[model samples]
Target: MVQNIKTNLPGQGDEDRKIRERMAKIKHKILVISGKGGVGKSTFAANLAYAFVADGDSAGILDIDIHGPSQGRITGIEGLQMTINPDNSIKPIEKGGVRIVTMASLLQDSDQPVIWRGPLKMKAIKQFLGDIDWGELDWLVIDSPPGTGDEPLSAVQLLPEMDGSVIITQPQDLSLLDARKTVKFSQTIGVKVLGIVENMSGFICPHCGKRTDIFKSGGGKKAAEEMKVPFLGSIPIEPAIMESGEMGKPFVWMFPDAESSKIMKEIAGKIRAELEK
Candidate 1:
């Protein structure tokens, strides 16, 4: 028979207090989440943070993906170890004008699997929030692993005063079905749904400037309307977006002239307006 595990670990109260104190310094907190993976959620999170930074706000990305952390690689800080301050607080790595913390920096090998259970994953996320020296940031974009699981739950429970969450979904029926669940999950947990982003909404031909509905567009906006949440905007699929990530650069910052970049900037601006209001 399986034995019961204690819910309260040692120093749990201390960590909770520390988390509150640290989070208080950040002006706005946004969680980027999806119902399932492979919808460019992480990419959107990274670029969203950069977009805020580009608009003259200090931003940071706390990658809580745990088992599949990609912000380090996407932000171009992979393989860089985090430093500790004399006061014992962990320092976040700064790159491309945004500070970042990810499990990627803690791993000895890139291919090493996280192999952690729910409670263990929660503890790591807590430490990242409470123990890290995030300093004063205008925005903290949290990139949570897809689904309404342990990592996202832990973050939501810890950050009760968070601004809201931005749900990322593709423009397809299968993805839209999961996106609806994601919206309901936010509601069930008492977290406000800031908006839904239709990523990979379409493909823009770079050479001929023709638009192709590769994934069939407008589903995300329709879902947002049905659910009564704001529809942030759509980001088209662009070759440059993929290349920018591979090169450890955010597309919005690296290719400001690209159409995708302009749309992302508009989305960021809407979020900023909502929060600043």
Candidate 2:
């Protein structure tokens, strides 16, 4: 049987101190969150990190989606275990110019499920921020699982210096409704709402080069306006995005010339502008 990993619970003096010391080295931190799932949030977080790297900044991704950690696969580091230094600090896995810390990397088996409670999940997140040797990074993009729950709440409360959050949603009413809630959640927690991203907004037919509103586009922008947050940009549905995820390659890096990639880069630029300001 695999041994259970013990972590210091939040609010412990030493643990909180370590978290602050480590986070201080990072210039900026961003939380990528969504109100509901299946809106391409994790994928956007990975690509955003890659986008920052492409723009000549050092980036790292902290995947706090403890239950469904996909950054390991999304960043091309699947099945790779994180190592420990002589000092007992955990080392994050580096891939494609972005350092990654995810539960997927630590799992002995990829198929194994993380059956953890709220407190256990919070402890694990604290360990990720405090115990890992992240070094200095220009951006630490945290990919949080959907909803206003344990993972997102823990990260925000821990990283008080976080720059802001990027809410992701599809261009549909249902997704927009939850996305509005996410914006409100960020506001409630005192985290800046950097903007909202509309992913899979439209589909581009490769054969005819015609655009189709597969998900009925424009709801994200409308919601952003209604919520008084910036509307970052919209990403169209492209086949290569899925392929890139499966191949462990970031879509923006793999297909820089593609329309979707361009939009993602533009979104990244907007975020940089906001954070740098």
Candidate 3:
């Protein structure tokens, strides 16, 4: 059950303690971050959450992308919306048995925008952590906005016990360069780099069934090797992925037998193994 966020109620001190205790019971907290945008970080987070739930585990995806919230879309639950409970805490919407929280759900309308600065971002992150009752989740997948900016930093600081961070990047030189900066930022903050994910490594021509290096693949693997971080594998670019995202369905869920789905599941397995170790 989702708990409501209460305002100026009696016994507020005791209620706060209960919330903290509930949060402490969660097993794993993972942040999916990227230094550059358009690299499919939200998609990765959503599919990973779906895979976990599909396997009978309870998971949630929290979108800390204040300026560009899209996890609800990736999960195919866009426009459904969330509601604030009597306690004043916002309840996360559930889809396919996976609990999700995003700025999109909190918006007054689809066209609304979140225009805020550093302190505001920090406060929102804190509210999502301290006020909301997330219950006991096996995994909490947080999709952060691009770069090692205020949002990502705030999330890390709020959850001091985060298991690690997964960095997403493309197969382009420029993207790899920025991704390196993300790796360094994580290291500086004492967060482990679980691995690097290469999104859009190649594109498959529908008619030819041939793989083309649209963005010049292998850069991410090379970067991972040079940085001494594990390589989680690559996700090939497919037009179907975009179509699926638009239609409110993840490619992995829509076509679990497709090549892209296979890769995503493999990456999820690697993440699971790393967390276990």
Candidate 4:
């Protein structure tokens, strides 16, 4: 993807300086974060980057979920390793229209644990922003690890001009409680909260053709209203979404014509509109 750059990108000396130089080419950056795990935050981040691809814009997924980096597998680029460029910078692996950068590519084994402390993780994240040759991108969608931990904080601190954050949550109260904390974290950091996405909002029985509140519905929207943030959209719990992930493809692409995909697209559209403002 970086075949046209003629400048000899030198080795990184000062981290902050390098990140400022590299991220300048990216027009927008979105941090997909959640307060807790199992909220499908990474999956949403992957699909969102690909959604931009479907819209004919260049995109990249930076899976900063250090310990559980899933963007490589989710974007169908699992097992692909990062290549070193002649200028001594690491090249991001491309799949379809999205460039994917993940700790998954750096690990020798898929099941190997990261086992890093805060300082180490922060260094790795710094290298991701500073050393990777992301080139010019319309969007850089980052999948931050759950909670307001070092990974997420490091990402926010690195991107001085980050567009904002996209918070993900489920329909239950437990998730909502933590989601509120997420909103507060973004505010405390001076980063704007772009919106919230309610994932696994409802489920439709494939056989009965009936909808069920498997996880209890409407809490996400209610929370957004109470928090005074934009509730982007709700995504139904479709079995195909899970199946698509297991098969290493995004649900939005596998079921582009389905109801879930439409909702996701609408949410993506809403996010784009808000960002363009």
Weakest 10 consecutive residues, lDDT, candidate 3?
Answer: 1-10
Q: Tell me the TM-score of model 4.
A: 0.93
Q: Can you write out model 3's per-residue Cα lDDT over 10-63, one digit (the tens) per residue?
A: 234654455456568778888898888889899888888877776677888889
* Tens-digit lDDT track of model 2 for 99-197: 999999888998989999998998999999999999999999999998888898788778777789999999989898998999988888878899999
**Judged by lDDT relative to the true structure, which candidate is superior, 1 or 3?**
1
Which of the predicted structures, 3 or 4, would earn the higher TM-score when compared with the native? 4
How accurate locally is residue 141 in candidate 4, as Cα lDDT from 0 to 100?
A: 93
- Cα-based lDDT for every prediction: 0.89, 0.89, 0.82, 0.85
| Model 2: lowest-lDDT 10 consecutive positions | 1-10
Per residue, candidate 4 scores C-alpha lDDT tens digits across 1-277 of 2121113233355766778788999999999999999899988987888777777889999989899888877877789889999989999998877888999999999988889999899789889998999999999999988888888777776675778899999999999998788888887776788888999988899999899998998878887888899999898898888788878889877777888888887888888899887
Better of 3 and 4 by lDDT: 4
- For each candidate in turn, the TM-score is 0.95, 0.95, 0.90, 0.93
Candidate 1: global Cα-lDDT?
0.89
Relative to the unseen true structure, what is the Cα RMSD of model 3?
5.9
